[model samples]
Target chain A: MEHFIETIGRNMFAIFGVMALVGGLLMIASKSAIHSVLGFLFAMLNIAGCFLALEAEFLGVAQILVYAGGIVVLFLFVVMLVEVSKKKEGEVFQLQSRYAVAAVAVGAAMFLAVFRKAFFGVASPEALVLRPELAKGLDVAHQNAQAVSRGLFADYLLPFEILSVILLVALVGAVVLAKTERV
Target chain B: MVSLNAVLLISFLLFSIGIAGVLIRRNALIILMCVELMLNAANLNFIAFARHNGSVAGQAFALLVMGFAAAEVAVGLALVVALYRRRDTVQVDDINLLKG
Candidate 1:
């Protein structure tokens, strides 16, 4: 039974990880802004799934709440407000296709170089194993949210407080920038 | 269990796709979405490493990154909206007022 569960979990991770990568690619390839937003939504949800697969349930839920709920909505609102449908369809991509090709090639080369050295060559398989101490806190019996909150309020209190201030500044900035001046 | 390498590879692929989108897309909104994708990729890395190392710090950092990403998107979209109003289009190529 345990082995069966492990297999299912591994498969879930593979599926969601591929979904995220493909969704990101679709976002890039789509011409319509709406389509790109949809793709971005798909990618964000799958990344949340990947987070769950990694056993970080709190972060996974936060991913859905913050990203899928908040960020994607913001993107959609801007898309609607901007009148992107009015732009000429052919103008979706910049004229310099050559630069895109070069950029993709460079990105692919970087991936291959790192993959070859890290996974296939020097890094041992043991490196992939979860450390026993970390795994102990994350076991299925423990409350992930409680653990996360404990960490946030105790060890990470300063950053937590600063994040709230940063969020406030961003809120003010957005309002100032998006608000139209009244005559 | 899924290997850490597999998870990291997925993140890398998403990040690379994001880079391509930022380079190729003309619309500022799409570019911003692509940047979000890249940020999510980094968040995935942080989570995966956190799991592998058996530490909560990775998850904490990921949460922090998420907060920062939210702030960034809010400001970024506001800037995009302001730019569109000023220039009448979101195409990056045409908005060359700041070009040096």
Candidate 2:
């Protein structure tokens, strides 16, 4: 019964993972800008679910809070502010559809090459193995925001501080760029 | 348990889709969204590897990446808005004033 439940959980994770991928594709392939943004939201939510499946509960919640709550709203605001005229509505793609095909081919080739190397490069045909010690640690850290905060504050303190500065700079830059001067 | 390879494959596919979107899409906003998709794909890889290797560093880095992504979106959207104001359009092909 435990094994069955575990299998079910694993399958659910796979479904979420696939959903994330498909949502990304949808975002890219959609004709309307609003549709693309909606697709991005879907992708973001599913990615957060993926984080939860991996037992990174803090990251998952942060993804939801930061991405779904903050970023998506920001995107929607920008979309609403920017007027899409009738002329622009028809021009969904660029002039280089052929180039897009080439791009897709190149990307697919890269994925295949890397996938082949990662999976088949080693001579040993062993199944995926989880590190027991790390697994135990992660199991403890799972759904534990405190563990993530400890690591952020202790080990990655400098980066955390630097990120705050970056955010501030971005805020200032955005204001400067978007604000129109009234003459 | 789900295999790391499966997770990685999904990430790769998402990344490729983002690439395709970036290449094909003319709208700067959609392109920005595609870039976010790519970033999310990379983050998925980080979390997956962290889980497989049993380290918290990957998750930490992923968080940092998310922060950077948010900053990037802010600046990027601002630039887009400014461009639209100046050129009255957000199409990449239309913004060719810098093509000297």
Q: Using DockQ, give the best candidate's number.
A: 1
Q: Which docking class does model 2 fall in? A: medium
Q: How would you encode candidate 2's per-residue C-alpha lDDT over A72-174 as one tens digit per residue?
A: 9998888777855536556676646787687679778887888877772322222223345433445354345655666566678899899999999999999
User: Clashes in model 1: which pairs?
Assistant: A134-B54
Candidate 2 residue lDDT tens string, B60-95: 889999999999999999999999888888888888
lDDT by residue (B11-52, candidate 1, tens digit) is 888988888788878888999998999999999998877777
lDDT of 1 by residue, A1-183 (tens): 999997776589889999988889889888778888999999999999999887788888999999888999988988888854585556666646787687689879987888877772222222222335434555433577766666666678899899999999999999999889773
Query: A-chain TM-score per prediction?
Result: 0.78, 0.77
Which residue segments of model 1 deviate by more than 4 Å? A1-7, A95-104, A117-141
DockQ (C-alpha) of model 2?
0.57
Docking class of 1: medium
